[model samples]
Target: MPVCFNPLDLLMKNITPRSQIKRGENHSTRDVLLRLFLLLGIFFLLFPLRTVVAAESSGSDQQLIRMSEILRNKEKALQEKELLLREKEKRLAVLQQELQQKEKDIELLRQRAEKVLAEFQALKDEDLSRLVAVFSAMKPVAAAPLLEKLDLPYAVEVILRMQPRKAAKLLSAVNAERAAAISRSITSAKAAVE
Candidate 1:
């Protein structure tokens, strides 16, 4: 294998005087060359140190870039969350509006139902009064058989609406079982009212 000489060594060799070329010959020129080599060796060593420092700086820059990228990703996630929250808020607002509208509609329906119920109750009361007048004109014996054929509740209502003396005569004319049941229903209804 061919031996390779360092370029610095070749330069030193060329600068030496012909008289000092002999091996082990000490001279001022040799000392000067040694000093030059030491200084150049120090410079070469420091050059590698500078390269190491530059590499470290570049590594820090890469870390900064990575950190910045992470921050950007987090910011993007936050923005997406904010958008989702806004969408949810919009949905909630719409739902509230719908709920309010439904409540208004329910209120209107309830009012209408109340009005219809009131009209129906008035009509029922009028019909009951007319029925009472018809029954009151009849003799107790004649009304009693017809009242017995009616539904229990209707018969009881008609009898209760008549004068006390007429209602008593009618009750006496009715079948004992039906009269007793009607009396029980009337008693229970009065008890509930009290």
Candidate 2:
């Protein structure tokens, strides 16, 4: 076999352990410098992004607070409306009760008025009956002359209440027009009764 001499292998064999250690220390110092620069670049790139994200989060929080306030105001308004509705209902109930009481009072007044009217009518009837009796006891000639001086309606009422024969006698003594009016009034009064 022929011997082939290699220069790289011979140099490696001649290198000292102290020189290898010095080379390794230099490579370690470069690695530390590279790692420091990479960390500074990452911090610079991410800082603005972090600031923008924080600003957006603050804006969202303000919007959420405003929405909450609006909801609270709406709830307060609804509660006020409910209270107003209840008050109106109470007022309506009171008004209805007052109206019912007024109706009852009106009915009572009407009943009292009817009773008073009936009592007044009874007194008028009694007075008319007594007047008729007084005129009937008198002589027809005397009664007729007195009746002629009275108002037509009063004379007619007195004549109509007398006995038929006495009424006829008294009427015959009066003027023809007066007797006719009395007869007509009596006929109408009888018709009203029927």
Candidate 3:
């Protein structure tokens, strides 16, 4: 393999005069080159330090002012976050309370529905006479819905208990065959519940 040398090294070697380069009182060329390299190294090493010192000298008060502003901004943001969290918590609490109240309302509605269902279940042919008795006392026009809630026998009893005029009118509105059947059975009917 062939050897290869740097171009700058070859140039330096060719420029040597008087068979040797000599040291001088003022400074040798090598010494000047060394001093230049040292100065360059010192400048490089102190570059960031010089910048910091310059910044400190020119704007230390400004730096402090900026730091305080940043701190205040962070504090405000923290306070806003805290306030938002508290508000959210309050809203959550209100929603929880509303949910609990809704649950209570639902339970009450369920209980009332059960009670109504029980009352409905308790009614049967045995209560026919009692329904008729109540319908007899109530106006026919007003008692229709109550009678309607009852079974066929009870409804017939209630209709028969009405005044002849009203009963005739209601019977006309009612199914003829069913009304006749109820009219025949009502006289012998008694209330019974399941």
Model 3, residue 15: what's the lDDT? Answer: 48
**lDDT at 91 for candidate 3?**
100
TM-scores for candidates 1 onward, in order: 0.77, 0.64, 0.37
Candidate order by decreasing TM-score? 1, 2, 3
Off by over 4 Å in 3: 1-55, 124-194
Name the Cα RMSD for model 2: 14.0
Whole-structure CA lDDT of model 2: 0.80
lDDT-wise, the better of 1 and 2 is 1
- Rank ordering of all candidates by lDDT, starting from the highest: 1, 2, 3
Query: What's the distance in Å from true for residue 71, model 1?
Result: 1.0
Residue-wise lDDT of candidate 3 within 1-194, one digit each (tens)? 88966444543554444346456534467755755665676678679879888888769878889999999999999999999999999999999999999999999999999998888767744465566566666665576555555677556656765677777655655555666776766655644321
